[model samples]
Target: MDEMPFCVHDVLNRPLFQRAIVLAGAQGIYREVRWVHILEIIHAAPYVSKHDLILTTGLWLKRSAKSGLEYMRQIIEHQTAGLCIEFGTTVDEIPDQIIDLCDSYDFPLILFRQPVRFEEITQDIHAHIINQHFGLLKKLEQFSQQQQQLILQSTDIPAILRLLQSYSEHQILYLSRIEANTYFPPLPEEMREAINTFCNQQMKHSDQIQEMELWKMDEHRYVLIQPVVCFGQVFSYVGMLLHQAHPTEYMKLLVDYTSKAVATVLLRTQFLEEKILSNQNELIQDILNRSIDSEEQAQMRMGLPSPNGEKYIFVGGIIEFEHNVIEAGPERMESRNQDVLVLIRSLLKRDRMHHVLMMKNNQIYLLCAKARIGKDSESSLYHKIQGLIDGLNKYINQAWPHFHFHIGFGKSRTMLLDAWMSFKEAFQVIELSQTVPAMKQNHYYASIGVYQLLHAVPYPILSDFVQDQLGDLIAYENKHHLHLIDTLAMYFKCMGSKGETAKRLFIHRQTLYNRLDKISDILGEDYFQPQRRHCLEMAMLGYPLIESYHADQ
Candidate 1:
């Protein structure tokens, strides 16, 4: 602290100024002395300034005791550091009235035991003050170097705070607005409450306040707050609390410097995090798009476990964010995304799962190693993939209950080269489920049944196939306003049971038989043969897609 050099008590502790004794104002002994000034006239108070330690021979005050009292008041009014009265010249001894005035004002009054040259006193005190300033500057330089080293070594905030606390010798509390928590050296319950309350009130006023300020929480404690600002916004605050009601100017300076260092660390950390996230997203996109030419290249880019001919299952999940929720604001979406990422990463790490997770086009994709734990079962991969999906969904729902989110998993692939197919399968399952009402949550490729195969077939091929098999009946039904196609489908569904087909169609047996006779005339008698019937049934299974395609045409 520069305090020792600029203090009246420390000045007296020096050998050259040791002859000085306090006549009154003992309570003000610790007043800081900024400069030493010689005062020979009674009207010198006008020229005095704060922290100026006055040296005098009491030449004017001896002429009138009443003026001595007035001079003390003037000294106190100007907030001078202290008054030193030389006892050997002009005045024999200090006046009782002057002493009382000094005590009342809490002003420091010193009695010089012997004759002391004003030039000598000023020279010595000013030299000490300069040395004190130089020492503080040196210390500040060292602190800057140390902080730079610490930042380069690690980006841990707690470690940084611990170092800063040692240098400051004061209790420190770091409140992160981004993390929504207080960190660093722990605080007492009462102290934490007081700081939290103060922060809340300040945020209510303006969250962008970046300046340092002091608050006297009580007679024994004072808090200094220095905000960590980035891009004209305050993201956190570093607060210092001391037992003294008023801390030294030097201590305040240290606090400001530490807060600035904290801000630098935060900005650097954020930049690195963003850079890493971007790289991860790019790698994930490359993998899912089949742009990654080789598994070796993937391992090099992500430092992930090498596939090395190992199998992996690609699980893609999409949150069809409600338009209203998205329209609400970007902040809400950003918060939710962060929560999801954190949860997924945590779960992945906890389970020691070899996985890659990233966000692409507002959807999250996960790729996990498909290594079997023991004897592989039909449902082992399903259970594994389902567990990850359920865990992520549960956490997300817990965090944001008002929002609706659905998750889907895909089939496992035996080769890394087929990862892109797995990703597409998972994505398609999600799209199909949401598009088709019959699809359920947690939908997967296997659960999609024949619809999966129908989707794989091109719309033109499926339409041509449908036309080749059922074109005549479809044309007849369209021309006559009769549902021969429906009747045929029901007949096929009921395995050609006349009574069952009629019952399912809500028609009489006579009506079904008549429709079947017309269908036979359009398709020929050979249509009901085993091979032709199989082809017709296959086309029937894909009829919906084929019909939709023809309608669009």
Candidate 2:
């Protein structure tokens, strides 16, 4: 039911003239003879369609010699398949101008002897066009089969690059991060400068400028740059610098496939690591509960050998009210460790007196100096611990904003089991202090012993009472522009020092005092009074308990 397709070559190859024999009636030179029109002919121009088998004689030729040539030039410009000139017409000779135009334009110009009928060539011309279409379809099918196989069998990145190079005729290809960094391999000086400028400007303005390409780098090379985003983070970039004049449609398809494959590989690897880590975390917790010979023996069982006689335990946790803001995948966690570990180690190194330190999960354990009872060294050690925690908090606040950190430190213990007990107590205090209003803003509360008797009390009784007292203030602070609740919390943390709180908040001293006075007036309590400050601090610490109870209800 489909119509026949047309081809320029098939039309050119059509036999327009019949061979003449004196004896018999003229024999047909081909199975059919069809009329061919030249679009340049004045009368024929209007009737010509895009792919018409145009037919014409030189009837429109003018007296001037230049006219014949200009006529042929016009016909060629129209992209006609071929021109047929009848020798028996008013123009007995084919003009040189016509011949020259046909040659220059690479157009077919066929000559017909007298008495050739154009109608005979139509059927045979249509049949030839159909055959060419079948041939093209077969080639496309073979190519598709080959490409599918290539995609399935390939694993090596270089091998895939080579395959793409051979297929696309492009020489250069590379993967880069969306977050361009100094550690990346150097680029051409000019290109490097441009990219650096672009990155710096983009950081100041917006993060939306994701990817770009450098075109016209050289006559022989074409470039493509694409952004790679993994797990909702812009991770890297994949670039291709091809030594080809231009890219083809197939090359684009290959690039898309390769990018997706790389993402899949990265995702799978992260999942595997997390699966292993989760198992190990459970195993470590089990070991902690069991009675181990010594902390050194525990380390050995955990595949970590202790180097010195001392040990310390640090417990920390990330608090996120909304889990979606936090990235839980293993790859994200590992990436975060790059900056966090540096901060932790830097803090530990600043106190060079501490002998050994080890990081386990969110907690850091250190084997620090021991104090004799008479030396009053416990107070000094407490100060050092407070300083370390404060430094960590400051670093984390600037580097990561969405999450808050809670740190718990335990004193050094001789036995591994004793260290485990200290770590457990510290972790429990961290949990309990979240419920108690009085201890909330206090960084280190030494009143609670290594046993967590406070944590056993139901949080609701304390939480509800505090919430009832502070509910309106909390709601108003959360609703309006000013952050009164955080201000109160920070004020208590700085030991009611207005200047210190102002410095921490990056506000003027007078501004902090004004806000504190306003808070005092609204709550009908003096801001400077120790009793009021203690009550507010306790209320803030008990917020987590209030939140938990509300959630359960």
RMSD of each candidate relative to the true structure: 12.6, 14.9
Counting clashing residue pairs in each candidate, in order, gives 0, 24
- Against the true structure, candidate 1 reaches a TM-score of 0.51
| Runs of candidate 2 exceeding 4 Å displacement | 1-222, 226-236, 242-245, 249-268, 284-315, 319-553
- The estimated TM-scores of all candidates read 0.51, 0.37
Q: Report every candidate's CA lDDT.
A: 0.72, 0.52
Residue 416's lDDT in candidate 2:
42
Ten contiguous residues with the weakest lDDT in model 2? 22-31
lDDT of 1 by residue, 496-523 (tens): 7999999888998999889999988998
Clashes in candidate 2: how many?
24
Backbone clash pairs for candidate 1 read none
Where model 1 places Cα greater than 4 Å from the true spot, the runs are 1-5, 16-19, 42-46, 60-74, 92-100, 178-209, 280-553
- Candidate 1's error at 118, in angstroms? 2.6
